[model samples]
Target: MDYIIKNEKLKLIYEPGKGAWTYHLRIPNSEHIEGKWGEIKVSGSIDDYKLESRNLALTKEGDKILSINNEIRTAINKKGGEGSNFNAYSQCSINCNFSLSVAIL
Candidate 1:
């Protein structure tokens, strides 16, 4: 099922069944920002090696916020290994309000 949260100025539709993908981002008097392959895509390097998201977990905060936590593993081997391979966790918080805010931790 799709999850939804909205406020005075914004609305968000999230598809938890599809890896918690963002289905639609709506703003008043503006065109909607749609997502085809999920809205949040996180990519970075671990020990100078490329790393990518492997899994995700979602949590809802009240009626206007959604929290998505990403777990990353499967290190991509590259030159210059810093130390040892490890797992990484990232949290993305989406808030819908008059003053909207998005935070990645």
Candidate 2:
């Protein structure tokens, strides 16, 4: 699993659990607005993410028809910490399909 950002490779570590998979992503040399930056830690479960299905709507007017676009619901999170105190940087939904494609990155 290769996670790439701006052509730079990212390091991802995976810890398998009985019900879920935990991921630790390490972004090297993350920069801040003030130029002071450090390592960024993100952790989450495989089930905590999801890809929603899109819906379409149509309307008819005599002999005409219309269509509506649907949006995808995505849940992305960035977490940090060491051991039991691991904290999530953002709100993450605990329901998603797990993929190991990005685990080896």
Candidate 3:
């Protein structure tokens, strides 16, 4: 089964195996991911990218993205509840990322 999580532009696709989960995150890139030959298409809006550029966390462009991503990961792990296998996914991560990346202008 697929556990899909997303907010606005970014999205994550999670596939759970017997003991592990495979993750596919759709992130904005300078070059858009195109669809052809069955390859997964990656795309983003410039406005969104610009907005992300304004995030206080990402202002300097160091490890903030990594930090943010980790925070999101942690949040996602916590979202599935305490006893329900905890194998679900959450789009809250995306919102967190977006909020951390919103533009001032």
Candidate 4:
């Protein structure tokens, strides 16, 4: 999924998993904050979910912030099957540990 900043015309790419979701945010060129890309993990029951991620790191052009070595385990509930009222907790990490929770929906 892609999200538009609406105010800055920025496009964000998001990857979704079972009871979790990750995203790669594109930074604007104007802000000195520098552009960054990271992932997030969300877990919990279908009705409720918990999310967490690493911090964002500064990156330059063609620079990779998140890497396979930076992945981290997130706390979640164990339940939910393929298609049932069940709730299962799962674990997932991004390329790097530099990430933060954007939102939960």
The list of candidate 4 runs beyond 4 A from truth reads 1-6, 14-22, 34-54, 62-105
Q: Give per-model TM-scores.
A: 0.21, 0.22, 0.21, 0.23
Q: List per-prediction Cα lDDT, in the order shown.
A: 0.28, 0.24, 0.25, 0.27
Q: Candidate 1 at 24: error in angstroms?
A: 25
CA shift of 95, model 1, Å: 13
Flag regions of model 3 displaced more than 4 Å. 1-8, 16-21, 32-72, 77-105
**Residue-level error in angstroms, candidate 3, position 83:** 21
lDDT by residue for model 3 (1-105), tens? 222222323334344551222333223331221222223211222222211221212212222221123344454442221111111121232323221121111
Name the top TM-score candidate.
4
For 45-84, candidate 4 gives per-residue lDDT tens digits of 3224322333333444633222111122122222211111
Deviation from truth (RMSD, Å), model 1: 14.2
Error of 1 at 56 (Å): 5.9
Cα error, candidate 4, residue 49 (Å): 11
**Deviation (Å) of 33 in candidate 3:** 12
- Model 1 spans with C-alpha error above 4 angstroms: 1-37, 52-57, 61-105
TM-score of 3: 0.21
Clashes of each: 0, 4, 1, 14
If ranked by lDDT, best first, what sequence of candidates would result? 1, 4, 3, 2
What would the TM-score be for candidate 1 when compared with the true structure? 0.21
User: Which is the winner by lDDT between candidate 2 and candidate 3?
Assistant: 3
